[model samples]
Target: MTAPVTASRGRVPASATAGRGPLGGASLPTWLAAAAAGMCAAAGWLRVLPGTRMALLLALAATAPLLLAAASRLLRRTASTRDTRPDGGPRPPTAPPPAPAPVSRSVPASTPVLMPVPLTLGLSLAVAAPVAAAGFWGSPARFAQAAAAAVDGWAHLLATTVPAGPAPLLATGPFLLVWVAAAITGELLARTTRAAWAVVTPAAVVFAASCALAGGTAYAVTAAAAFTLGGVLLLRARARDLRGPVPVATRPARVARVARAGAAAVAALAVAAVVVPHLPARPRVDPRDHVTVPDTPLTGVNPLDRVSPWLSTPDTELFRVTGDGPLPQRLALVALDAYDGRTWTSTARYRPAGSGVPHAPSGGRRLTVEVTVAGLGGVALPAVERPVRLDGPATLAVDPDTGLLLDTGGLAPGLRYTMTSLLPAPPQPADVDAAPRDPAPATALPPGVPAEIDALARTAIGGETRPGAQARLLAAHLWARVRNDPGSAPGHGYGRLAAVAATGVGGAEQIAALYAVAARGLGLPVRLIVGFTVPEGANGLVRSGDVAVWPQVRLGGLGWVSFGPTAQAAPGWQAAPAPTAAPLPSTPPRVVPGAGVPTPGDRLASDGPLPVRRPDWPLIALIAAAVLATAWLSPRVGRAVRRRRRRSRPVPADRIAAAFQEVVDTAARAGSPVAASATVRQALDRVDTAIDRRRPPDNDFAPRQADLHVLRELTERAVYGARPLTTAEADDAWARADRLRRRLRRPAPLRRRRP
Candidate 1:
């Protein structure tokens, strides 16, 4: 027969007769469930996806009722056992309770089977549909591309199977598989073992998904959803078991315990997912254009000579010059009198008839040239008729025969050379009357010369009296009228000089060649000066090797006079009288320099290489201080996190019972009837059951049997049992107890039915 229980002053008193059992010391699962739910909510606030949020909520909701029930049952069982004691003092230790009988098919059931299936399917569809739509409709190609790119990116991260398409799918597919598998596995484990598989299953799924989705889209959300769903199902199953035979009476306390554990697990997994994959050591980038410039000079290598059929046509720049002074008229380099299809050689070997010293005419002037030479292939420099001296560190030697500079080392930047050129007075008509006779080699023509040359020449010079006058008149007329269009057809090559003379229009090289041929035909000496022309403001003049082609006509007494028919030289020349004061001793042949020159210590005073400036120490100190401050704060944040986690841990079932008893004691002290020996779970369940029955369970003896059942199971499993309760089971028990407690505490008409 059951022993009779008593109450005192409308309050239930703590029992002293209860023996120590596993259930007596167990923590409630409710606190853990609540904690997990709270963590999920926080993750949602931090921008975790909706699917994840729903999954977590479902898990919490599904297991909450069960957890609360277990907590309530545990409290009741504890109180009843205590009340059976003979005295109020601590009871002697008793033998451990007998092992529960194996669950049989005959046992009555209260909950429905297969509750999670519908929910799981609905959630899966909801998550997948939108993703599918995005991939198929919004932009299939872009989706594919993004996926492919993401996969390729991750290929650098993980040793994964190569997918045919985008990379996101690789991670996404694996994530889905792992998540589903984990969920099923967790549910089965919970059903078979009554162990909380919620935390482990979800955590494992999340970890695997995170690894796959390190750089993938929606990874965090997917991982969270998978974990939450699996955990919730497992917890729900555990909660059901807790509510079955053994019941806890401390509903309120157990609820709190389950809530804390759930919250901690959720928070930890979320943080782990976010933090782990972001560690460095990412893939190396390979850019398309990554050619390294060669350090050695490129001489004798004509970049334009080998025209590869496989390569695109080359781009040729019509000379560019930069300098400080007004743009120049015409800057000549070398003269070419002979040409094959590929080469242009000078008429004959150069032979200097005079001393090596250049002789500028009486009206000569000094012009400083800072030439930056580039792209000259076997070509020679064509300076003014006479260049007195060159001043630059460049190792360019003068070819005495051709009066040109030769440097096999090839042209480079920052070349500075000073030249004193003879500024000859403009020629008068009488000067043209005495044209010079053709020189030996100048009169000889290349074999390919076109037949139309003689006729075209005769027609061009017919009106002029003298050969010199004729050549000048023709040159002047051609320059004014001929349009310089380099894009035109080759027009009979250099051999068709006569055809060019007739047309009176051609490219720069063509016109220059024609002039040479015409002048030669007229029995006058002329040379085809194939050299680059420089405009004023041209800087960095090194050796004369930089010039392109032009034409030069020999005057009877005066040497060759440079004339550019394609691009006329700058005008306005006033011949200066010979200097009376013996020209300032040639500037003592100073060691003028070009690029790559190392200035001596004394020369550092002049404009030398710029120095690398160092930053002020004060600024550096401030930056250092800021870094230190940040470092100092980081550990504080870490400590705060640890404290929060500790607080979030599942509350012990006894503590929950104590809290419930305290509430009851306070109420009892206020003149309400109370039982003489009662557990927290029993009081809470009695109160809820009494309300449900629409009748108070004798004031202090309020029935909370349902709640006690939940609490007792959670307490026994968590405290005395070796296996820890799962997040799902703890959550369910907590939720049920909370609802029952709230109802029991209600003022009036809304009381619930008692068991």
Candidate 2:
């Protein structure tokens, strides 16, 4: 070998390749690295927003040809550079050897690098096919409307004439055909250029951003963070590659140090962002909002035994009675002998009979009562004294003083408790007593006792002589003469009883109280009964367990008769001749007083039916769990079935070789300068070598041989005579190969397989 080329210092020129950069040029790697970085960033972003990710993915899929074109451009550029000498002149070809057999290089693993574009485009189309079909056939108008709504500024630009009827071929048919054509073209370009990542990255980024925006801030933040982290990891990987080789010991130590530093930084940031702001002082909540004190007293461990007039309203319902038997004449809760301004307290401490239950009175007609109760404030079922017998399922106790049944456990809704109320028949006049000493507290006359009240009481009973008759006469007069006008008197005034008695007018409670005070003051054995009044036309009743106050006075040994002095004294009392007429020899018959017809007091006592029980939580939970399980399993099963089908069918060989050739040609066109004598396998091998040499092909010339395996196999079968090829098979092979070539020339990532 003659004289060797030498450098200026007299050293041989080594190999003319000594000063060349990796891959023979600087621009290709720079561009490819930039494109790869951009693609990585875009893919990261796509993971953040679902809708945007879907849309971009669809668009990328539709434009596969463009990606292939880019890959081909890259390959061509790369090849051109490789073919030229360092000084820029084309290298001289060596003389051909005589009688040489046709030779082909085996395909290399790296050939897939040039296939990104066409592969991405094909995948994009495959992915979007179903969506496109849905949009085309199933309510195209609705689909367009939804898309328009999702795209904020472009709504007006959207076409409104959706393919409605079937006859006009010009409508959806042509549009769909064009769309399919565009998609096919894009796929072909992608296969040829292998620049799939270039096409896919932007679409992915846009899609991710859109999804993030649509999902709201919480979702957006999480998505953005995840994408950012992925991008950082990619960057780190690229950086590591750029750093070149290092001593094994030093490399391990450096990697460990970096990892530790990164971990500490992450920990510190997490603590700062999430853990330090909730430790400040706060004000205490008010005690009144937490608890309520019980103002009424109880007996026999029943909370409902006590009745406070202050808390009682005239119309509040206490119970409801429903049965074939007549309703008990009077639903009495408790009897109070003493009165303060707001409440009635018993004058004497109760003395329980032998078993703590009040003993029945000696003689009286017994009446049965069935009661249902609701609400949560009480635990007692009220009834008159001397009940013959109690039935139904419920725990019963008695108030020692009032001799009323105190139901210990709160009444359940729809509960039916029975009681026999003993009503004494009207006693003979001779059997009645004149008067009895009062055991109750002395009445306290507040300032301004009305003069008329005393004079009226005196006038009505003065001539009667007998204490019992006098009490009855006075009650009858007041009930017949006074009007029950809530506004007839000045503000419920300071002297409540005195004022009401003087004016002969007041609210139901005030008037009732006056009647009680006046009757008791007359020396009759009178007791104040606090309970609700039943009104007319009340269809249903809700037993709130609330008690309303009224008065009950004894007529000698004849027993108590329940009546509302306030109601009788009201202005409308005489509008309808008393519900019953006085017994007269001349008159035939009249509605009996206090018989079948419900009084105003009774209506007030019954409101509406009560509920049975609380809702069941376990049944609801079980149903929810079943629904979730079904939802979770459906998609997985579908995917598995599809995968099985794909595995069962293998691709033909000629198609594989054809696809390989397409990728090689696309790469060459893209400036990657793959060897002409190289078979698809050889080209793949060269790509692998290039990658191992840390010189990735240009983005446009990225290989896609992995995706084109089926096409390559088919091509090999056709060329090597492994199998007979039909015209359709040849066409398919060419088409697939062409598509793969375009994809290899593009700058985007290869697309995923379609479902």
Q: Considering summed lDDT, which 10 consecutive residues are worst modelled in model 1?
A: 599-608
Compose the digit string of candidate 1's lDDT tens values, residues 9-70: 22222232111122221123423442343234223211211234334433333343334334
Indicate which candidate wins on lDDT: 2
Cα lDDT listed for each candidate: 0.40, 0.41
Task: Please give the RMSD of candidate 2 to the true structure.
Answer: 28.8
Error of 1 at 523 (Å): 1.6
What TM-score would each prediction reach against the true structure? 0.30, 0.32
Q: What tens digits encode model 2's per-residue C-alpha lDDT throughout 1-755?
A: 11111111122222222212222112233334333433333333222212343335433433332344445556654664465678988789978633211122232222333435456545544434444435444543344533333343122111111111121111222222223433443333223223333323443454353342223334344545554454454344333332222323233335654665476447544543442222222222322123332222444422213333323333445567654554443455555666544434444222211121222343455566576664423554556444545554424444433556554455666666666655544332233335333333344433443565567678767767675455545655655655555334332233765666665556555556666666655655555665433333343252332234565555422345344443322222332213421111111122233332112121111111111234344654554465467446644554344323322223433233333443453454444545333344445555443332332356623344443454545544544453566656656665655555444434532331110
Error of 2 at 750 (Å): 99
